[model samples]
Each structure stands twice: as structure tokens, then as C-alpha cells.
Target: MTRGKWVAGAVLSAAILVALVVAGVRIWDVHQMTSDWALWPKEVPSKVQFANRDYQCGANPMPNTHSLDGLTKQGKTAGGADIYSAAPGTQSGTATWIVIKTGQATYTCDLMGGP
Candidate 1:
């Protein structure tokens, strides 16, 4: 191959390698986070953030209002649990949630923000 063509090929290969490395690292980090969620502290938290959408509860059933994942501000539920939206100006994201109870007063936020 010509010298100029060889140089171009080398540069392109390097760029692709770098991009792959970045993507792999991100996927690994997410996997680690998801695995660690099983050990999530069972405490009433003011705010919750979980990378995995599914919250594991063998026999425990999540509340109906808490199951929906979306934006909410001053949102009220039939169970009388007050909720607030995480980001006010963003559109709703598609994800499911299962409320896992911690203690007497802690809120178990599943899959991110709520409706």
C-alpha cells in the first residue's frame, strides 16, 4: 500500500480502538452498578437512583402509584404518599418500578424519577 494510505488506515484503526474501549468501560461500569444494587441500603431515602429498572422483591408487592416511572410534581396517590418529580422540564422516560420498603418512613424509589 502507499505510505499515505497506510498512515490513514493506522489513524482510523486507532480511532476505532479508542471508541470501543470507551464503550466497553461504560458497559462494565453499568454492570457493576446493577450488581451492587442488590445490597442497597434499606433506609428511607429522600431521593433514589437505581440503574436497573427492576427492583427485586420475592413476595413483596410494590405500590401501584410507585410502579409508574415518569415526571411528577406535588403528585398525590390514593395511598396518600406524596411524590415529586426529579426533573421538571424533561419528558417522561419509559421504565417500570417496584417499591421496596426499607423502614417505617423510608421511600423506595425504583428505576429513577416518579410520576
Candidate 2:
């Protein structure tokens, strides 16, 4: 092959390689974003990078009873359910909240104006 032909082939190969790399990165990013898109009750926290935006857990209050049954305070994700917490007994204004999760989905309670 002539010198000119060899240079042209090298440039073309380099361009194709770059294009493939860029395309691969884009495809991987899209897949990651959409994989968690279908999660229930979408409320991702600020620290999470998988989401496009940060969200504060709304105040979803529990029912009349403060059921602390069979749950540890400051529990781990291993609970496989919503974690519950509340202020001391019978206090007029105590923050009662639940950190609920199912599968990979997790979110804080959106209690109605109760801190």
C-alpha cells in the first residue's frame, strides 16, 4: 500500500473506534437510568446519583396507633419493610415517620405536617 493510503486507513480506524466508545458509554448510561425508572413511589434522596433530581421524603403519617411491634429503632435495610420511628410516649408533637422499602425501592414517609 502507498504511504498516503496507510495514513488514511489509520485515521478512519481511529475515528470508528472513538465513535464506538462514545456510543457504548451512552447506551450504558441510558440503561442504568431506566432500570430503576419503574420503581414504586418514586422518591430518591439527594445523595443518590442514579436519579436526575433530588427529592425530599414527603410527610406520610401513620394510622392512629404507633405500632413499634417487632421493629428495631434505627433499623437496617435488611428489615425488608418500612422502618418505624416516633418520639417519646404521648408527646404532643413528636416526629413519627416510616422508612419503607420493597425490593430495590426505598423512600421516607410523607407524614402530613408532623415533624
Which candidate comes out best when scored by TM-score?
1
lDDT of 1: 0.43
Tens digit of per-residue lDDT, candidate 2, span 29-109: 543432232223223321122112222343342234434554344433222344444434634554444544444544654
- Model 1, span 1-115: residue lDDT tens: 9999999999999999999898777655544533333223223222333432333322233433343255444343223344444443464563344343322432444554333
Q: Per-candidate TM vs. native? A: 0.37, 0.33
* lDDT of candidate 2 at residue 111, scale 0 to 100: 40
